[model samples]
Target: MPDTSFPGAWSVDAEGSAPPFEQLRARVLDLVTSGDLPAGFRLPPVRTLAEQLGLAANTVARAYKELEADGIVETHGRGGTLVSAQGDAARRAAQQAAAEYAAKTRSLGITEADALELARTALSLR
Candidate 1:
């Protein structure tokens, strides 16, 4: 149930090692994964997204382009953009994998304190 009424603003996870674009991509991917935005759901146009985010249109376009190239989205001419059929399942699987990895680390007695420490170190390296 992603609110499609407006451009969603995502908070940057300062501790995460991933770059901003990757983090953005992951969030979008997770949207698909979580069934928040199902297949054929139209995404906001690139320009609108840029305006909403206060980012250069190209920045958002680049992210959209990457997602399109990955078969996660498809253009609909004047009809706008829509999510891919397989993308939902694929993204969900990927998100689950990421969650599993975190679980594995935590299961080894890695505390949240240690997790935050690792994230901070990774961010510093990045």
Candidate 2:
């Protein structure tokens, strides 16, 4: 599990690169998607993640809310947030999309051999 700590002072990006809450959301999503954060892995509490990221507690709360809305994460009483097991649906969607891509690529003049290779390589990365 990644270590959790309080950041103490809030310092969101003034450059507008991405809102603090959005960045937090994206990072959590990527972590969950890449399997770096596995299913059932607990997330830092909103206050804890907010403090550690130098953000407002409300920002973290917003991020978690968005994650939950998208079915990427879940919350339970005071137990904290966690990656969703519903990730299976997301994986299925990705597989279907990949199948469509493979067909489209072949139709676009990509050789069957090359398309197969592409699918293999893409699935391998997952």
Candidate 3:
């Protein structure tokens, strides 16, 4: 029995703008990035978490799929899903941040070339 008691009080706001899966995904990502849910922490099975959160099993599954796709967690058949190593999580986080930045730039009408240049400048400053 993996500890289903997630570190903090995580809940999906049904009335919030974001869908339940996105909310769950973002919360888990935050926990991983903040080290609250350290590497090797096993997440509850999708059905289990969905029941606990009163969400559809598919919703939980989708969230887990996205997390796995982002390399923040690894799903091993019966072994269950566990948080990835810290270095991997950090790299994934940076990639996710870059994706979000690109989306924001696009929304702001910034060209792809400008966005890449801005990112380059930002990296050069470090």
Candidate 4:
């Protein structure tokens, strides 16, 4: 379970190919969808989270904006950011499936490019 009191569950791979915002977004989504962050759980402010994660505030802000657009969270002005209640089940299931797939790929020592290509191929088949 993630530490609900802080953004301690999130970490950036400084040498990773993925961008900071993308990593932060994924971490936040995973935490929320996995129920580590329960319904009505509040996220730290963008500046606070950025400071915690050693990222620019703009990067964290972009992640928050994207999350809001995806209905994972909602901002209530002075009330701050809260996790949305509606999409939890669906998001949790999807997150679980993706985690399983990622674990399998990692166990197989799959390269990032190959995994991405596999995902692209799967998408194209639909």
* Order of the predicted models by TM-score, top scorer first: 3, 4, 2, 1
Can you list the residue pairs that collide in candidate 4? Answer: none
Give the Å shift of residue 69 in candidate 3: 0.5
lDDT of 4 by residue, 9-121 (tens): 54888887778998887787878867777778888888888887899999988988888888888889978887888647546667887789888898999987888799789
Please identify which of the two predictions, 2 or 3, would achieve the higher lDDT against the true structure.
3
Off by over 4 Å in 3: 86-126
Measured with C-alpha atoms, the lDDT of residue 60 in candidate 3 is 93
lDDT (tens digit, per residue) of candidate 3 on 1-126: 657568868788999878999989988987888878888999999988999999999999999999998889899999998897742665666888999999999999999999999999987652
- The Cα error of candidate 3 at residue 103, in Å, is 15
- Best-matching candidate per lDDT: 3
Candidate 3 has what TM-score? Answer: 0.71
Candidate scoring better on lDDT of 1 and 4 = 4
Candidate closest to the true structure, highest TM-score: 3
Ten contiguous residues with the weakest lDDT in model 4: 1-10
Weakest 10 consecutive residues, lDDT, candidate 3?
84-93
Model 2: per-residue Cα lDDT at residue 47: 77
Per-residue alpha-carbon lDDT of candidate 1 for residues 4-110, written as tens digits (9 for 90 to 100)? 43335575454677755566666777687777778888887877776666666777677777777777878788777778897865656567876886898788888
Candidate 2 — which residues are off by over 4 angstroms?
1-14, 88-126
Using TM-score as the yardstick, the better of models 2 and 4 is: 4
Displacement of the residue 54 alpha carbon in candidate 2, Å: 0.6
